[model samples]
Target chain A: DQQVKQNSPSLSVQEGRISILNCDYTNSMFDYFLWYKKYPAEGPTFLISISSIKDKNEDGRFTVFLNKSAKHLSLHIVPSQPGDSAVYFCAALVTDSWGKFQFGAGTQVVVTP
Target chain B: NAGVTQTPKFRILKIGQSMTLQCAQDMNHNYMYWYRQDPGMGLKLIYYSVGAGITDKGEVPNGYNVSRSTTEDFPLRLELAAPSQTSVYFCASSSSEAGNTEAFFGQGTRLTVV
Candidate 1:
């Protein structure tokens, strides 16, 4: 079973606009959520994360919002730049199980110049 | 420093053949994992190691084996290659520490079986 799901396989947005990537999870036991960005032929890099206790976390141009009640979380990139185009994967950490992580299929975002 | 290095970035194997995929991490991480990604699908864990001499299977461990002889190296072995095994494999490492659970992945190895 896929505990984490990214329904949208692809997304497109204009440069200098907002780009939002959504993720949903079925396992309520997951408390830590993370977002990773990957480029073509490269490994994924950590972007940002939030805990179950917090509703939102922000870093510069990127922000992650978590809604525990809805079992959903999203990554928001404001004033999106061309360089932001890549595949984004949402992951949840299962700390109790020796820190095992569950990841979504991923969403490919294209920022138009 | 090379955080996580996976050798043979790309490979093609014939059905019934066998080979091993090498993975090493310079970060001295206690937790190492092997994952495979199929087309249009998320990564599935094949195997994982907590430290030297301790290993366990993950979501999709069939047709694959792993050995963790040292903390710095973890290798995956395919006993009998199959066409369904063709996919991109990724090696990742992370710390079990409270604040450093973020995983670092290697570039990945694309394996094709024909």
Candidate 2:
């Protein structure tokens, strides 16, 4: 069974707009949530992460919001740029689980200029 | 710095063939993992090691094996290649120390089993 899920398989956004990608997880034990961006034929790179203790975390143009009560998390990109076009994956992990991450089906984001 | 390195960016194998996927990291991370990504599916963990000589199976361990002989190297072995084992394989490493939660991944190896 897939513990993490990204309901949207793909999203298209205009440049300079806000892009939101959402994820839901069934496991309540997960306390660390992260987002990764992947370009074609490349490995996924870490974008941002949020700890369960905090509701939101931000870095530059990217922000991750976690709603532990709802078992949902969302990643937002402000002023989305064409360079941000890639597949974004949501992952969660329990700190004690040997750092094994449970990944969600990635959401492909296309930023149109 | 080479965060993580995987050998043979691509490979093709006939049925019943066996091969080892090589992975190395220079970050000295104690945790290493092998994961497979299928078309339109999320990455599923195959095996992982917390330190040298300590390996454990993850969600998907069938037809796969792994060994961690050193902090920098983790190799995955496929005993008998099957069509179902065809997928993109990724090797990642992370430190279990406090405040280091992110994992560094290699470019990945695309494997095709005939």
Candidate 3:
């Protein structure tokens, strides 16, 4: 069974606009969540993350919000640039699971000029 | 630094064949993991190792095996290739230190079974 789900398969937005990607999880044991950005033929790269203790975490143009009670999280990239067009995956980690990560299907974001 | 390295970026195997996907890391991380990504599906964990000489199965460990003989190497073995095993494999490593939950990944190895 998939513990993490990214219902949206794709998203398109104008450059310099905000791009939002949402994810949900069914396992409440997940205490930490992360976002990874992947380019074609490349491995996923860490983008941003939020601990369950906090509701939001921001780094420059990227922000991650976590709602533990709702078992949901979202990634926001403001002023989306052409380079931001890629597949984004949301992953959840349980504290004692030896760092095993449960990843969502992924959301393909396209930034249009 | 070469954070994580995977060999045979692309390989094609016949059914019933067996091969090993090599992985190495120079970061000296204590935790290493193997994951496979299928078309339109998210990455699924195959196996993981906490340290040298220690290994454990993950969500999708069937038809696969792994060995962690040293901190720098974690190799995945496909005992019998199958059509369903055709996918992109990724090797990742991360430090177990507190406040460092992110994992560094290799470029990935694409394997096709026919």
Docking class of 2: high
Computed on C-alpha atoms, the DockQ of candidate 2 is: 0.90
Docking quality category of candidate 3 according to DockQ thresholds: high
Q: Cα lDDT for residue A8, model 2? A: 98
Q: Which scores better on lDDT, 1 or 3?
A: 3
Write down the lDDT of every candidate, Cα atoms only. Answer: 0.94, 0.96, 0.96
lDDT of 3 by residue, B57-111 (tens): 9989999999999999999999889999999999999998888899999999999
State residue B25's C-alpha deviation in candidate 3, in Å: 0.6
Tens digits of per-residue lDDT for model 3, A1-113: 99999999999999999999999999999999999999999999999999899999999999999988899999999989999999999999996788999999999999999
Off by over 4 Å in 2: none
Clashing pairs in 3: none
The alpha-carbon lDDT assigned to residue A64 of candidate 3 equals: 96
Residue A10 CA displacement from its true place in model 1, Å: 0.3
Model 2, span A1-113: residue lDDT tens: 99999999999999999999999999999999999999988998999999999999999999999999899999999989999999999999999888999999999999999
lDDT, model 3, position A108? 95
Candidate 3 lDDT (Cα, 0 to 1): 0.96
